[model samples]
Target: MSAILPPSQRLWWKEPVERIEIVWIAIAFVWCLILTFMMPYWHVFGKQNLSNEAYRTTPQAFAAKAQAVVDKWKVREVNGVPVVKPPAGADIYLVGRLWQWWPAYELKKGESYRLHLSSMDWQHGFSLQPVNINTQVLPGYEMVITVTPNKAGEYTIVCNEYCGIGHHSMLGKIYVVD
Candidate 1:
Protein backbone atom coordinates (compact mmCIF):
# COMPACT_ATOMS: atom_id res chain seq x y z
CA MET A 1 0.00 0.00 0.00
CA SER A 2 1.21 3.56 -0.66
CA ALA A 3 1.63 6.23 2.05
CA ILE A 4 -1.59 7.93 3.13
CA LEU A 5 -2.41 10.86 0.81
CA PRO A 6 -3.78 14.28 1.80
CA PRO A 7 -7.57 14.71 1.80
CA SER A 8 -7.43 16.35 -1.62
CA GLN A 9 -5.34 13.50 -3.12
CA ARG A 10 -7.09 10.50 -1.45
CA LEU A 11 -8.50 8.01 -4.05
CA TRP A 12 -9.22 4.92 -1.92
CA TRP A 13 -13.00 5.17 -2.23
CA LYS A 14 -12.89 6.04 -5.94
CA GLU A 15 -10.77 3.14 -7.18
CA PRO A 16 -12.25 1.35 -10.23
CA VAL A 17 -12.01 -2.05 -8.51
CA GLU A 18 -13.78 -0.80 -5.37
CA ARG A 19 -16.47 0.84 -7.49
CA ILE A 20 -17.31 -2.48 -9.15
CA GLU A 21 -17.39 -4.22 -5.74
CA ILE A 22 -19.84 -1.64 -4.45
CA VAL A 23 -22.11 -2.10 -7.46
CA TRP A 24 -22.16 -5.89 -6.98
CA ILE A 25 -22.88 -5.44 -3.27
CA ALA A 26 -25.78 -3.14 -3.99
CA ILE A 27 -27.23 -5.58 -6.49
CA ALA A 28 -26.93 -8.46 -4.03
CA PHE A 29 -28.54 -6.43 -1.27
CA VAL A 30 -31.53 -5.54 -3.46
CA TRP A 31 -31.97 -9.17 -4.54
CA CYS A 32 -31.97 -10.33 -0.92
CA LEU A 33 -34.62 -7.71 -0.04
CA ILE A 34 -36.83 -8.99 -2.85
CA LEU A 35 -36.46 -12.57 -1.64
CA THR A 36 -37.11 -11.66 1.99
CA PHE A 37 -40.42 -10.01 1.04
CA MET A 38 -41.62 -13.09 -0.86
CA MET A 39 -41.09 -15.44 2.09
CA PRO A 40 -44.38 -16.67 3.70
CA TYR A 41 -43.55 -15.99 7.35
CA TRP A 42 -42.98 -12.27 6.66
CA HIS A 43 -46.45 -10.89 5.92
CA VAL A 44 -45.63 -7.20 6.19
CA PHE A 45 -45.59 -6.80 2.41
CA GLY A 46 -45.94 -8.87 -0.80
CA LYS A 47 -48.05 -11.37 1.09
CA GLN A 48 -50.33 -12.42 -1.75
CA ASN A 49 -53.34 -14.67 -1.20
CA LEU A 50 -52.48 -15.18 2.45
CA SER A 51 -55.31 -17.52 3.39
CA ASN A 52 -54.81 -19.87 0.45
CA GLU A 53 -51.08 -20.31 1.00
CA ALA A 54 -51.15 -20.26 4.79
CA TYR A 55 -54.13 -22.56 5.26
CA ARG A 56 -53.68 -24.77 2.18
CA THR A 57 -57.28 -23.95 1.29
CA THR A 58 -58.54 -23.04 -2.18
CA PRO A 59 -61.00 -20.27 -3.09
CA GLN A 60 -63.94 -22.62 -3.14
CA ALA A 61 -63.07 -23.99 0.28
CA PHE A 62 -63.00 -20.45 1.67
CA ALA A 63 -66.44 -19.42 0.36
CA ALA A 64 -68.23 -20.37 3.54
CA LYS A 65 -65.55 -18.80 5.66
CA ALA A 66 -65.69 -15.43 3.87
CA GLN A 67 -69.46 -15.38 4.10
CA ALA A 68 -69.30 -16.10 7.80
CA VAL A 69 -67.06 -13.12 8.47
CA VAL A 70 -69.07 -10.81 6.22
CA ASP A 71 -72.28 -11.64 8.03
CA LYS A 72 -70.83 -10.87 11.43
CA TRP A 73 -69.07 -7.68 10.29
CA LYS A 74 -72.25 -6.16 8.86
CA VAL A 75 -73.18 -4.71 12.23
CA ARG A 76 -70.87 -2.26 14.08
CA GLU A 77 -70.58 0.44 16.77
CA VAL A 78 -68.90 3.86 16.95
CA ASN A 79 -66.54 3.41 19.93
CA GLY A 80 -65.47 0.71 22.37
CA VAL A 81 -69.05 -0.12 23.32
CA PRO A 82 -70.84 -2.42 20.87
CA VAL A 83 -74.08 -1.46 19.17
CA VAL A 84 -74.35 -5.04 18.09
CA LYS A 85 -72.36 -8.11 19.12
CA PRO A 86 -68.70 -7.52 17.96
CA PRO A 87 -68.22 -10.98 16.41
CA ALA A 88 -66.06 -12.10 19.34
CA GLY A 89 -62.70 -10.67 18.08
CA ALA A 90 -60.41 -7.60 17.93
CA ASP A 91 -61.64 -4.62 15.85
CA ILE A 92 -60.24 -1.21 14.76
CA TYR A 93 -62.05 2.00 13.78
CA LEU A 94 -60.79 5.31 12.36
CA VAL A 95 -62.22 8.82 12.45
CA GLY A 96 -62.44 11.16 9.45
CA ARG A 97 -61.95 14.28 11.57
CA LEU A 98 -58.39 15.58 11.67
CA TRP A 99 -56.25 15.10 14.81
CA GLN A 100 -58.92 13.22 16.66
CA TRP A 101 -59.74 9.69 17.76
CA TRP A 102 -62.69 8.31 19.72
CA PRO A 103 -60.17 8.81 22.61
CA ALA A 104 -60.69 5.48 24.33
CA TYR A 105 -60.79 1.80 23.41
CA GLU A 106 -59.23 -0.88 25.58
CA LEU A 107 -58.58 -4.54 24.82
CA LYS A 108 -58.73 -7.43 27.23
CA LYS A 109 -55.97 -9.95 27.79
CA GLY A 110 -56.31 -13.21 25.84
CA GLU A 111 -59.81 -12.20 24.63
CA SER A 112 -60.22 -11.35 20.95
CA TYR A 113 -62.32 -8.54 19.37
CA ARG A 114 -63.40 -8.06 15.76
CA LEU A 115 -62.12 -4.76 14.28
CA HIS A 116 -64.69 -3.02 12.05
CA LEU A 117 -63.04 0.04 10.44
CA SER A 118 -64.47 2.80 8.23
CA SER A 119 -64.38 6.54 7.65
CA MET A 120 -67.18 8.86 8.68
CA ASP A 121 -66.26 11.54 6.12
CA TRP A 122 -63.29 11.26 3.72
CA GLN A 123 -60.89 8.39 3.22
CA HIS A 124 -58.71 7.85 6.28
CA GLY A 125 -55.84 5.53 7.21
CA PHE A 126 -56.00 3.38 10.33
CA SER A 127 -52.62 2.28 11.56
CA LEU A 128 -51.95 0.12 14.60
CA GLN A 129 -48.23 0.60 15.12
CA PRO A 130 -45.84 -1.58 17.14
CA VAL A 131 -47.50 -4.08 14.85
CA ASN A 132 -46.16 -2.59 11.56
CA ILE A 133 -49.68 -2.47 10.16
CA ASN A 134 -52.21 -0.21 8.40
CA THR A 135 -55.60 -0.42 6.70
CA GLN A 136 -57.75 1.95 4.65
CA VAL A 137 -60.96 3.33 6.09
CA LEU A 138 -63.00 4.67 3.20
CA PRO A 139 -66.01 6.95 3.50
CA GLY A 140 -69.41 5.23 3.51
CA TYR A 141 -67.63 1.91 2.98
CA GLU A 142 -66.59 -0.45 5.73
CA MET A 143 -63.53 -2.69 6.02
CA VAL A 144 -63.25 -5.25 8.73
CA ILE A 145 -59.79 -6.23 9.99
CA THR A 146 -59.19 -8.81 12.72
CA VAL A 147 -56.41 -8.60 15.31
CA THR A 148 -55.43 -10.64 18.35
CA PRO A 149 -53.73 -8.76 21.19
CA ASN A 150 -50.68 -10.92 21.84
CA LYS A 151 -48.65 -8.59 24.08
CA ALA A 152 -49.91 -6.41 26.89
CA GLY A 153 -48.76 -2.79 26.45
CA GLU A 154 -49.69 0.63 25.15
CA TYR A 155 -49.83 0.95 21.35
CA THR A 156 -50.44 3.92 19.08
CA ILE A 157 -53.05 4.06 16.35
CA VAL A 158 -51.95 6.80 13.98
CA CYS A 159 -53.17 7.99 10.61
CA ASN A 160 -50.73 6.84 7.94
CA GLU A 161 -52.60 8.53 5.04
CA TYR A 162 -52.27 12.28 4.76
CA CYS A 163 -55.41 14.19 5.82
CA GLY A 164 -54.66 17.71 7.01
CA ILE A 165 -52.41 20.00 9.11
CA GLY A 166 -52.91 17.78 12.15
CA HIS A 167 -51.92 14.62 10.28
CA HIS A 168 -48.76 14.20 12.31
CA SER A 169 -50.55 14.26 15.66
CA MET A 170 -53.50 12.06 14.71
CA LEU A 171 -52.85 9.41 17.31
CA GLY A 172 -54.85 7.20 19.68
CA LYS A 173 -54.01 4.61 22.29
CA ILE A 174 -54.73 0.93 22.69
CA TYR A 175 -54.06 -0.83 25.99
CA VAL A 176 -53.69 -4.55 25.48
CA VAL A 177 -54.50 -6.69 28.54
CA ASP A 178 -55.55 -5.13 31.86
Candidate 2:
Protein backbone atom coordinates (compact mmCIF):
# COMPACT_ATOMS: atom_id res chain seq x y z
CA MET A 1 0.00 0.00 0.00
CA SER A 2 2.89 2.40 0.80
CA ALA A 3 4.54 1.63 -2.56
CA ILE A 4 1.23 2.23 -4.42
CA LEU A 5 1.21 5.92 -3.39
CA PRO A 6 3.24 8.29 -5.58
CA PRO A 7 6.43 9.90 -4.15
CA SER A 8 4.85 13.39 -4.58
CA GLN A 9 1.73 12.50 -2.57
CA ARG A 10 3.47 10.36 0.06
CA LEU A 11 5.70 13.18 1.33
CA TRP A 12 3.70 16.24 0.26
CA TRP A 13 4.24 18.23 3.48
CA LYS A 14 7.93 17.41 3.64
CA GLU A 15 8.64 18.28 -0.05
CA PRO A 16 10.37 21.63 -0.79
CA VAL A 17 8.67 24.02 -3.20
CA GLU A 18 10.17 24.35 -6.73
CA ARG A 19 12.10 27.45 -7.85
CA ILE A 20 9.15 28.72 -9.92
CA GLU A 21 6.79 28.26 -6.94
CA ILE A 22 9.10 30.22 -4.66
CA VAL A 23 9.42 33.03 -7.25
CA TRP A 24 5.63 33.24 -7.65
CA ILE A 25 5.12 33.26 -3.87
CA ALA A 26 7.62 36.10 -3.52
CA ILE A 27 5.90 38.08 -6.30
CA ALA A 28 2.48 37.67 -4.65
CA PHE A 29 3.81 38.77 -1.27
CA VAL A 30 5.46 41.86 -2.83
CA TRP A 31 2.32 42.72 -4.74
CA CYS A 32 0.27 42.59 -1.52
CA LEU A 33 2.69 44.96 0.22
CA ILE A 34 2.56 47.40 -2.69
CA LEU A 35 -1.24 47.44 -2.61
CA THR A 36 -1.24 47.96 1.15
CA PHE A 37 1.13 50.91 0.79
CA MET A 38 -0.88 52.49 -2.06
CA MET A 39 -4.17 52.87 -0.20
CA PRO A 40 -2.96 55.41 2.38
CA TYR A 41 -0.89 57.27 -0.19
CA TRP A 42 -3.86 57.61 -2.53
CA HIS A 43 -6.12 58.80 0.26
CA VAL A 44 -3.67 61.51 1.22
CA PHE A 45 -2.80 62.76 -2.29
CA GLY A 46 -5.72 61.82 -4.52
CA LYS A 47 -8.56 63.68 -6.30
CA GLN A 48 -10.94 61.48 -4.35
CA ASN A 49 -10.26 63.35 -1.09
CA LEU A 50 -13.81 64.71 -1.20
CA SER A 51 -15.21 61.18 -1.24
CA ASN A 52 -13.91 60.48 2.24
CA GLU A 53 -15.31 63.66 3.82
CA ALA A 54 -19.03 63.87 4.59
CA TYR A 55 -21.36 65.80 6.90
CA ARG A 56 -24.15 64.00 8.75
CA THR A 57 -27.48 65.77 9.34
CA THR A 58 -31.19 65.14 9.15
CA PRO A 59 -33.11 66.07 6.04
CA GLN A 60 -35.22 68.64 7.87
CA ALA A 61 -32.21 70.26 9.45
CA PHE A 62 -30.30 70.45 6.20
CA ALA A 63 -33.35 71.79 4.40
CA ALA A 64 -33.71 74.64 6.88
CA LYS A 65 -30.08 75.53 6.46
CA ALA A 66 -30.43 75.44 2.68
CA GLN A 67 -33.55 77.58 2.86
CA ALA A 68 -31.70 80.20 4.83
CA VAL A 69 -29.04 80.38 2.16
CA VAL A 70 -31.69 80.70 -0.52
CA ASP A 71 -33.40 83.51 1.28
CA LYS A 72 -30.16 85.35 1.90
CA TRP A 73 -28.46 85.38 -1.49
CA LYS A 74 -31.39 85.03 -3.86
CA VAL A 75 -30.85 87.81 -6.40
CA ARG A 76 -33.73 87.52 -8.81
CA GLU A 77 -36.10 85.12 -10.54
CA VAL A 78 -35.57 83.67 -13.97
CA ASN A 79 -38.76 82.04 -15.14
CA GLY A 80 -39.93 81.28 -11.58
CA VAL A 81 -36.56 79.81 -10.58
CA PRO A 82 -34.71 81.89 -8.02
CA VAL A 83 -31.23 82.61 -9.29
CA VAL A 84 -28.74 82.47 -6.45
CA LYS A 85 -25.24 83.75 -6.90
CA PRO A 86 -23.21 82.74 -3.92
CA PRO A 87 -20.23 84.87 -2.99
CA ALA A 88 -17.08 83.65 -4.67
CA GLY A 89 -15.15 81.26 -2.45
CA ALA A 90 -18.12 80.63 -0.24
CA ASP A 91 -20.08 77.50 0.58
CA ILE A 92 -23.36 76.93 -1.28
CA TYR A 93 -26.19 74.55 -0.54
CA LEU A 94 -28.30 72.65 -3.04
CA VAL A 95 -31.26 70.56 -1.96
CA GLY A 96 -32.45 67.69 -4.11
CA ARG A 97 -35.97 66.32 -4.02
CA LEU A 98 -38.52 64.70 -6.32
CA TRP A 99 -38.38 66.42 -9.70
CA GLN A 100 -36.41 69.58 -8.76
CA TRP A 101 -33.10 71.03 -7.63
CA TRP A 102 -33.48 74.07 -5.42
CA PRO A 103 -31.90 77.54 -5.77
CA ALA A 104 -29.91 77.21 -8.97
CA TYR A 105 -26.59 78.97 -8.70
CA GLU A 106 -25.50 81.84 -10.95
CA LEU A 107 -21.78 81.54 -10.62
CA LYS A 108 -19.01 83.69 -12.10
CA LYS A 109 -17.07 82.41 -15.06
CA GLY A 110 -13.82 81.61 -13.27
CA GLU A 111 -14.73 81.28 -9.62
CA SER A 112 -14.76 78.21 -7.38
CA TYR A 113 -17.40 77.30 -4.85
CA ARG A 114 -17.90 74.50 -2.44
CA LEU A 115 -21.37 73.03 -3.10
CA HIS A 116 -23.09 71.32 -0.22
CA LEU A 117 -25.44 68.72 -1.67
CA SER A 118 -28.03 66.60 0.12
CA SER A 119 -31.38 65.00 -0.58
CA MET A 120 -34.60 65.99 1.06
CA ASP A 121 -36.88 63.01 0.52
CA TRP A 122 -35.05 60.25 -1.35
CA GLN A 123 -31.72 59.41 -2.91
CA HIS A 124 -30.93 61.53 -5.96
CA GLY A 125 -28.17 62.20 -8.50
CA PHE A 126 -26.10 65.34 -8.98
CA SER A 127 -25.14 65.52 -12.65
CA LEU A 128 -23.80 68.79 -13.97
CA GLN A 129 -24.15 68.88 -17.73
CA PRO A 130 -21.58 70.13 -20.28
CA VAL A 131 -18.85 70.21 -17.62
CA ASN A 132 -19.83 66.63 -16.72
CA ILE A 133 -19.55 66.61 -12.95
CA ASN A 134 -21.52 63.76 -11.47
CA THR A 135 -21.98 62.65 -7.85
CA GLN A 136 -24.37 60.70 -5.69
CA VAL A 137 -26.91 62.44 -3.44
CA LEU A 138 -27.89 60.51 -0.35
CA PRO A 139 -30.48 61.28 2.28
CA GLY A 140 -29.24 62.54 5.66
CA TYR A 141 -25.70 62.95 4.33
CA GLU A 142 -24.18 66.18 3.03
CA MET A 143 -21.65 65.83 0.24
CA VAL A 144 -19.43 68.74 -0.72
CA ILE A 145 -18.65 69.06 -4.42
CA THR A 146 -16.02 71.66 -5.19
CA VAL A 147 -16.64 73.20 -8.59
CA THR A 148 -15.02 75.97 -10.58
CA PRO A 149 -17.06 77.30 -13.43
CA ASN A 150 -14.83 77.74 -16.45
CA LYS A 151 -17.47 78.58 -19.03
CA ALA A 152 -20.20 81.18 -19.00
CA GLY A 153 -23.43 79.40 -19.84
CA GLU A 154 -26.48 77.76 -18.40
CA TYR A 155 -25.73 74.17 -17.50
CA THR A 156 -28.52 71.72 -16.91
CA ILE A 157 -28.52 69.52 -13.86
CA VAL A 158 -30.11 66.18 -14.65
CA CYS A 159 -30.84 63.31 -12.35
CA ASN A 160 -28.95 60.27 -13.63
CA GLU A 161 -30.61 57.91 -11.12
CA TYR A 162 -34.18 56.76 -11.15
CA CYS A 163 -35.98 57.77 -7.97
CA GLY A 164 -39.65 57.77 -8.89
CA ILE A 165 -42.30 58.43 -11.55
CA GLY A 166 -41.23 62.08 -11.70
CA HIS A 167 -37.60 61.15 -12.23
CA HIS A 168 -37.66 62.47 -15.80
CA SER A 169 -38.77 65.86 -14.54
CA MET A 170 -35.97 66.04 -12.02
CA LEU A 171 -34.28 68.88 -13.87
CA GLY A 172 -32.14 71.64 -12.39
CA LYS A 173 -29.94 74.44 -13.69
CA ILE A 174 -26.66 76.15 -12.86
CA TYR A 175 -25.92 79.34 -14.75
CA VAL A 176 -22.32 80.49 -14.99
CA VAL A 177 -22.21 84.17 -15.83
CA ASP A 178 -19.47 86.48 -16.97
- TM-score of each candidate structure, all chains considered together: 0.49, 0.73
- Residue 165 displacement in candidate 1 (angstroms): 1.3
User: Which segments of candidate 1 are over 4 A away from where they belong?
Assistant: 1-96
Query: How large is the C-alpha RMSD of every model relative to the true structure?
Result: 10.2, 4.7
- Per residue, candidate 2 scores C-alpha lDDT tens digits across 60-169 of 99889888888989998866878887899888889899978987889998888888999988899888898778899999899877777888998999998789999988
lDDT of each: 0.56, 0.86
Candidate 1 on 1-178: residue-level lDDT in tens?
Answer: 3355454546756645677888999999999988876775466553322222112333233334433443454344344422222334534443334665443355665666655554545556878878867766565554554456677877778888887777788776666654
lDDT of 2 at 142: 93
Candidate 2 CA-lDDT value: 0.86
**lDDT leader:** 2
lDDT of 1 at 32: 96
